[model samples]
Target chain A: MSAVLTPAVRRPLLRRLRPLGNGPLFTVAVLVLGVLVLVAALAPLIAPYDPEALDLRSSLVGSSADHLLGTDQSGRDVLSRLLYGARTGLLGPLLVVGLSTAGGLLLGTVAGWRGGWADAVLSRLMDLVFSVPGLLVAIMFVAVAGPGLTAPVIAMAVAYTPYVGRLVHGLARQEKARPYLESYRVQGWSGWTICVRHLLPNIAPTVLAQSAINFGYALMDLAALSFLGFGVQPPAADWGAMINDGESALQQGATMPALAPSVCIVLAVVAFGIVGEGIADRLARRER
Target chain B: MSGPTGLVVEGLRKGFGGRTVVDGVSFTLPPGGSLGIVGESGCGKTTTARMLVGLERADGGTVHLDGVDRSMRPRGRAGRLERARGIQLVFQDPYVSLDPRIPVGACIEEVRRLHFPLDRADRRHRVAELLDQVGLGEREAAELPRRLSGGQRQRVAIARALAAEPKVLILDEAVAALDVSIQAQILDLLAGIRRASGVAFLFVSHDLAVVRHLTEEVAVLRGGRVVETGPTVRVLTEPQHPYTRLLLDSVPRRGWDPGRIAAGRRAPA
Candidate 1:
């Protein structure tokens, strides 16, 4: 398929990425995601103070030039911690989306393209997996594995696989029924090639939008897990962990530290939702 | 021209929920032959056409291409693909048949690349040639299926099928979706290509006019069975089966009045 690649042929794809209407929403979503990713990537360089360094004298201090945003109960720089927190905040969801999308895509395509006994077995397995609520399952796994980053990440990845799998399976089944698959089969294209090259490309936008939506859910779920003390143990800067750490500050009449991370979590989720919606709208328009 | 591969089918049968859709259908087309399977909806023509091209597997029949039983073709990836390339099927709706995401050139190149080991430049050149053969130019090849008209998309689909170098081309209501004038143009194009390549054709259509124009031999199907089989002119002008006569009678006659038809029924009453 790549044998005919030309620079001229790629222009249409680039144009497709730029959403025609709802320009502001798409632009804002992209800008928000870009800023967060840049901040996470540049955390070591841009942070003013060590995220873990303790300043006992400055405990519970409010926002200032020396320690922006304020100091937590542990006297750690809130700004520095928040900036570093962006790393784990983003990485966890990235892991969940990546693993689940891959697993889901594979299983879904198999179930979809080769229906009958295969579809029945895989779909029943998905049903079994989907029956378990993701957050509850993650908590249970985290309990068994002991509280840590690896535990929650694994738990959430497993929990979310069925959701992505079902989406891909349905799309694959629908696409499988189309005449193009028959055409490809008659042309001697392998079933694998048809699923990967042709079927995937058609369903990719929807899958991508699904991934973005999954990202938001994963982000919120991970944050809640950390808040419940099952993810990202203390001494590590995490938005969710920071929010938990700053909870006592709220009782002490110092809400900035906790509120800051809470706001960041909401912003990240909202950004992903906007981006997913934008993609879905663009796909619908393109189909029309 | 290279001599065509003859296709022979016998006792082809298919069923869904114990209801047979194609029951004991059989036919033979010699090298460079064109056969039309004409029927109305649910007549099993499409099922029979699909089975002959390996799109739909037959439960109880043998399909032989060029004296080789299709089932006896090799079983491995390369071998199966090689056998599949010997026959191709073009579907009814060009809009749904071609992938909307890929450009028309890439669609054609996909089939070519699978069967041929040509370099990139040669593949691109061949794609251009195929497009031109179907009455499309270089600019149209760069566009996606959505960018083309119904007729143009069908042309691209035909071009893609031709890229496989098939000995037999099965068109299952392939042109039934196009406008009458566009259908005429596509039929002419098919005739020209057939003359040049000598590929045998199994043309399935509900349109008797199109069947008469594109096929030499006609097989009229009704209720999952072939009711009449003969030359197109013979079957159309002197239909032996009552079902065939009923189908031909359904076609509207020019200058015929509905009031006169009512008057005829009134005369019988």
Candidate 2:
């Protein structure tokens, strides 16, 4: 596909990234994501105070030189908690997206290529999964297995599989219908070889775009679970849990406790959404 | 040349949803023979070609290459590979026939690797050779299908089919998509290939001129049955079947009348 591109069209780096969305907003979203990841990675070094330390005398103090963004109701520094919260905030969604995408690719490719009883069964299973709301599944799993990140993450991963699976199933089925696949089969290439070598690569970009968008949704869902006390228990400094813990602080006139993490969650989710949509737009244009 | 090495298909039958698409279609092409099956759309010419290559399983009858039965759908990898060595097909559409993401040279090399137990170096050499046979250069070999023109892609498709080293090669309207000049070039190339290699040609086409040019024997199909069968020259110049005459008259030439052809086409056989 690259062979058809003219040198003039291929020259600019910005032109290549243009498919990710309009220039300035896409760049800003990427930058926000980059900063969040960096902050999460270097939380220990960047944070000025221990996120879990309780300073009762100084609790609920407004922002100052001593403790920026003020202390939460529990006296945990809001700024430090926000930085540390990035780790769990990003990690939960990462696991959900990774697991679901892998499962989706496997099940979808098999269903699409085989296209008989296997397709019917797998498609029905996916439809069943699709019928259930992801958050409801996560909450139910949390109720059964006790509250923690593990149960909800696994549940959400299973719940999210249908979105990716259905997309991949449709795309793979369309791709399998192309004459090239039949040509390969006619050449005596095995079905496995044709799928791994030709079919997967062609559908990879679209799947990648979907995964990017799924990452954002997964993040928000996980955060909502944590807020409901079904994920990331207290003192672990999760964005969703922090919002919950800061509810009392909001009434005490220290909005930074709840407001700061809320802002961060919204920023990360919106950035991921923009990046995913941009990539999808670019891929659509390239196909056209 | 009449030895049992070439394709011998007898009474091939296929029906979709109780409607017979190909019914008791039969033909034989001896080694080095060129046979054309010509018909209008829905005449089962394409279905017959598909059955020959084992892409479509026949409902009944047999397809034999080199005295081995290959009529049934292959059971396993070994069965499929054995059948592939017997016959190969070059599809009608060039644009969608080759894998878009794969380079042309690799596409040819893949078939070579699958059919033969050649080392990587030998496979590469053979790939170059096959490309050269199809009038493509090393530069085109490294490029993807999108970079090449329709004629060039068709050439690559031909090269890929030849790499399988099959005894029978089925061209299912293989040049129908090309313009006149390119079609002439492809026809010349195919003629040269036939001379160079004794691979039997099963040319499936609707174009009377192409059938006349490329085939020695011709089978005229109508309504899922052969309406006429004879030497290409005899069939084109002095068609015996009324349906064959209608087909020939339908071809545009000097003073061709669309109205008369339409009426003739509308009339029942």
Candidate 3:
């Protein structure tokens, strides 16, 4: 690890990262994510004042130094709420989306690599879930399993496993036809080894591209659930809950709650879309 | 690594639905002897090779080595994967026959890992030996197939096939995809390998002239049947079968030479 930071690897990593620094999309995503994550992770460090420690006299107040982004209906500092709220809005989805994407990558890799009954069984079960509405499935799951960050991640993983799995399955089938893969098979390398050593490296670029798309899909799904009150609960504050809270305030003209969270949602989704498109094009060119 | 071992195929029958692609295909190679199968593309030459190596199953037939009739049955489950430990196939495309991601040495070295499972240093030494046998060196082995020319990749492919140290080697159009100059060079390599290792080779080709350059005996296949089989010159100059004569006639002759129909190689109304 120490040697890795030496001149050779670092130079290439910096060169690739250079493109990222200049790209408008990358800059915006990094900025938004950086602020949100920092404020969330170091709430004690940078938050000017306590979040739950509020002055009711400041209730429903508009932005001031003491109450930037203003105070909510309960007089909780909206800025403070926004900061702490990120810990849920961003953190919850980050957890849920990350877990589900990992799950999807695994199933997709397995289904793609292991054909026959393994593919058939996983494909059909995923089809069963894809047949029904994913959001409806998420709702039913929250109803039965009880709503928490974990439940939605589980629900979303089950709902979207087929999407990633199908992509993986298709990619794996194509990879099996590639000359190099055939070379390994003829070498009489065992099946498991071939899948891991040969197939995994070939399939990685496609799976990762699909995963980025999955991350965006998971974010939108989770926010929608939170909007309907099935996601991370409020009073703890979240982007989706803030959207719900700001509806009446919109009539009253305090728009930051609705505006800010929505902006975060759009930014997260578009970031994933841009990164996925870039990777997908690179992979398509390679395939050609 | 190939040629000390022998291969035998008997009554090898494989089919789709009820249509047999390869039917009753049978042959044997004495240790280090070579057998050439000349066939048009669809006459089941590739399928027979695939079955001999167990890539595809034979519905009914037996593959034997050392007079031990191998799972003397179809290409199906149970026919000599144990046998495959010593049998290798050199496919048509040198480009398609190797994993592009690894260095050429790693590809040959893969067989060493399979049969010997040695540590990295020992494996590298073995691979370097195999590469030298195929007219390559450690420096050549370190490069990837993408970096090499078509002929060189094929040479690497041959090195990889020999890595298994098999007694029998199958060359399925191995030189067919190459240009004539390159093909000639590969033919010379194959001949040298055969002479040195006594590894029996089953060379499959459509070009009789190219086969003429490498093989001792030739079997001409037409529609899954051997139309002519004998010593190479006997089959070529003194062709007994009409199809063999027509096939020889199909070979392009020099300027002002008569076409097969005008030369009695083919009938003219």
lDDT by residue for model 3 (A102-218), tens: 666567667766677888887887788779887888888899988767677677777777777677778777887665676666566655777778887877787777776677767
Predicted complex 2: DockQ: 0.73
What is the C-alpha local distance difference test score of each model?
0.87, 0.90, 0.75
Clashes of each: 0, 1, 11
Rank order (by TM-score, best first): 2, 1, 3
The lDDT ranking, best first, is 2, 1, 3
Candidate 2: which docking quality band?
medium
1 or 2, greater by TM-score: 2
True contacts kept of each: 0.82, 0.68, 0.38
Give candidate 2 misplaced runs (Cα > 4 Å): A1-22, B1-5
Stretches > 4 Å off in candidate 3: A1-14, A17-55, A66-68, A79-114, B1-5, B16-19, B68-81, B118-121, B255-269
What TM-score, over all chains together, does every model reach? 0.91, 0.94, 0.86
Q: lDDT tens digits, residues A1-288, model 1?
A: 565776568768766666445588787778788899999999999999899998888999988888779899989999999999999999999999999999999999999988999999999999998998888888888878898788888888988899999999999989887997778877877789889888898898899998998899899999999998999988899989888998999999999889999999999999899999888888888778
B1-269 in candidate 3: lDDT tens per residue?
35333667777787877777787877767677788998767888988887777666678888877766555433522333345555788999987778878899887877777766656667887788778877888777889888999999999999888887777898999998898899989899999998888788899889898788888888888666666778988898999987787777767776535653466633531
Q: Highest TM-score among the candidates is held by which one?
A: 2
Cα lDDT of model 2 by residue, B74-134, tens digit? 8888898988888889999999998888898988988888888757678888888999999
